[model samples]
Target: MQLTFDADVEEFRRKFVEFLDEHMPAPGDVTERSKSSAHVPDWARRWQRLMFEHGWLLPGNPPEFGGRNATVLQQYVHLEELSKRRIYHSFNPQGLGIIAASILSFGTDEQKQRWAVPILRAEITAALGMSEPGAGSDLAGLRTRAVRAGAEYVVDGQKVWTSGAHDADVLLTFVRTDPTAPKHRGISVLLIPTDTPGVTRRPFPSVCSPDDLDFNEVYFEGARVPVANRIGPENGGWQVANGSLGHERTLLWLSFADRLEDLLGDFRPRTELDRDAYARLVMDSYALRMLGSGALAAAARGEQDTAALSILKVLGSEASQAASERALDAVGIEGLTHPAVTAPPPPLNIEHFSASWFERYLRSFAGTIAGGTSEIQRNIIAQRVLGLPRS
Candidate 1:
């Protein structure tokens, strides 16, 4: 279901739409090419510079720290507009959004100056190295150790599923600083340069397809980082990690609108076997969009309901699955058969959609698994939101 906006919001939408239409990189161009393994594409960096020059890359930070200091409503409006156009600047994500935000909230002034400007200007890119092979959802179990020396911390551990690490200039990594302390208490966050000695990156094949590029494994062996690089207090990295995840959950869920539009395309199966199933799909998609906007509104108000995020994570994944399944059933033989030809020229060509549907289906399957699994979300909602007793 579509929604009506207030006049002011409608005007914001108009400008946003116009900006994206004018500035967004064309598909199949150099800007659209997928980089090697979790690497930042050059076109994406150019796009980030464009946003920086336009003063839209990161709007919440102070003007001194490379942000527009836009209001929360404006931020929501901007994000919504960009998501609608499937436009996201890749290079500035770390410096402007996560890393810079984290630092501005906690880091020393010198640290911010040294790091924040370059990130905002698209000069440096950073990847998050939080999930390890043995520890992903259960972050407390992370075995990566950061042993402190006189003035540096020597990090030695493996981080799995480190997205965009290969092309990143730095890594905001979480490690255990004090094993003796309780699980979550002893952890620390470090901003380690990827070029630091003993840091290695290896590509991991995608579960869905080799053509899909993202995901990587990182090994840190005596990866030395200055003590000054720590974002928050030692053993208090959980808060930083949680904060990053909170932001990520919101951002990831916002992408569902694009998924919905992709499902609504012409090649979508026309045959409706069950009226109830079709109705359920339509209703669920509507609900997802409404809840997404509601979440955005709340976030703009400086309030984020994790329960709402959890519900959206689970429901949106299910909705994506349902839409894909229904579309496949609708397309029948065509769905089963792989595309044999390249897409034709502009507006008419959507072969990318066809090629990506199955991959998206499999990737969305992990949506429930990534931020927090469905089981984890259910427990969170039950215990935190519903105030249920732990079993």
Candidate 2:
């Protein structure tokens, strides 16, 4: 089936393109890159704030939350255009996409005003503190503990792989509030300020690049967070965590699709083997885009097919990894010596796979592991979609 938008949505896209042409930042204005995924530079912050002011930051939310209550189709078009252009709505993606979305989904009116508004407006940033040293894929295995004492909860534990924690203003942290209870039942989430007396963050470099210091290990040594900071009911954090992960996985395929499309557009095969690989990647990218469109259509109809989301996640991420690898392979050893390695980094907002094939290939590994590993996603698809028993 051919995908097309109605007249109003087309008009919306036209207007959005015009807006970008009028206000998009010049390349020189955002030349410096922190090389970290989580840090937002001055120009990015200003760009996000400007979009918020114009109600383009989140077109589905109310004006106070930087939206015009645009239709679902309009929001889809908006995101599509931004991804096609490799523009970042927020430099702190986890803060805007996952944290703010979770707060809006489950937070009280007071909490929404206190936390989500500033996030959408780019006034302050947030990070998710779920993965601990002991807990990576299995969140129920986490060991961090927070005990209640009068009006505060004294927290003590270590969280690893807490991306952007070093630069974030706050962390949506998960802790075990009732260890005696079953593993999943007594979990809870807290909005802990990163600057609390007992909180510490140590950033570590990743394999993607020596300059790309994005991952952090956070320590909480008797950190005292007010009991009022708890999100949702105590011992009900599993539900909140599920909501956050669901939001995180739902639309992430769009970025992978955009990247694959970009790679496919620029590919020029040098040999018979290269042509065969390029053809396979093209078909895979086409299938992924079609699946994404179908998922979006279902969402617009208010039908939640979670199994479809799992399939999209698996296909989109793996396809992107394959495409990046192919791009690097096609270049042979010379790919390793691209100028991006020695040159000052390209502006984060405008650069895509074209930035550096080597860097892109290294960074692609995180895509499989980030939201959930490919192994976990396959198990989900097997059990939920294929009617197979859990192994």
Candidate 3:
């Protein structure tokens, strides 16, 4: 299959590049910011809204749902360009790219009207409640309970590694509705407001830095949410969550592929990435882009492409980790401790990059761990793609 962008997509890329060059933040102008949606600044909110108003935020979304109904080729071009420029689309990128899209698949008409449009409009942000304190990779094993009580479902549970919970207005939460059912069954999804009476949250440390509140721990103590807020049928949340995970994996591969390219561009000459190693990494990154493009193509054609998503996640996440290793090798010891420094301007201008290398290297492990672990992805590829038996 053809790999490079077609003429139409190339032209589309040119237009978007010009638009981003006009609006994206400059190195000096960029504020010191945590990577959390919780710490969204006024400028970030405006920037997100600006992109949304221009029909640039959710390019692949349908027009009825506030997207441009963009072709898959266009979607690939859009994400790659954003990554090339190192643009953070919004503080709530996950909400727009993953959560909102999932809602379209599983939400009721009222649910769509209430949440999806506002998310696309950037009027509010959301967080995912997937990983619990005890159940990280084994999501089906979560113990959080939500029992239906007439008009409301009273929820009581704790979620950890919940990114941006502090700033999120709503949560796409998974809970056990039937304790007697199988591990994967009897679970349900809830669209609960974060400000509910029994809800509480606290920040957690990450390798990005000790003080960085990138992850959060959220607790629900008999949190009452309207029964109407449920996504899909009761005890059928596993299916809805599966849909959300598909969107998330697709977006993650896109983000990581672009980021790998940008990282190379940012530190190629300064870091000690030798010719052979650099070429290898470049090819690996190219392969990732190709896989990502394939996934996008399938999506554009309204296909699931589960195998592609799983393959891309496994390969892309490992490639990023390997790329980070090379970057660290180039930086040696200095990057491990130093947290800020001036970068080469213009052609190689990478703001917040000089002293951020090792820290980024540390955080890169999360890529492999989150969105289903590398081991899990491998099992998926082995079992689903290769049609292997569950040994």
| Best model per TM-score | 2
Minimal lDDT window, size 10, model 3? 343-352
Instruction: Give one digit per residue, the lDDT tens place, for model 3 in 1-391.
Output: 7657679889888888887878876555545464576445666667777777777887777666755777877877887776655566766766886778888898888888899878766788888899997899888999999999999999999999998888888989999999999989989999989999999989888767686566889999989999999999999999987888877776578777766776677556453346567788899899987777677777867887777788888888888888878867777787677542354433212224644678778878988987889888889889888999999
Q: Which residue pairs does candidate 3 place in steric collision?
A: none
lDDT of each residue in 1-391, candidate 2, tens digit only? 6479989999999999999889998888987664454677878889889998998988887888888888878988999888766688888888888898888888889999999988887788898999998899999999999999999999999999888889899999999999999999989999999999999999998777666577999999999999888999999999999999887887888888887886777657899999999999999998998898999899888898888888998998898899879878988777776632344433545343334678778878888988888888999899998999985
After superposing candidate 2 on the true structure, give the runs of residues whose Cα lies further than 4 Å from its correct spot. 339-356
* Model 1: ten consecutive residues of lowest lDDT: 342-351
Predict model 1's lDDT versus the native.
Answer: 0.71
**Best of the two (1, 3) by TM-score:** 3
User: Where does candidate 1 stray beyond 4 Å?
Assistant: 1-11, 14-32, 36-38, 91-97, 300-302, 332-356
**Which predicted model would earn the best lDDT?**
2
Q: How do the predictions measure up, each by TM-score?
A: 0.86, 0.94, 0.88
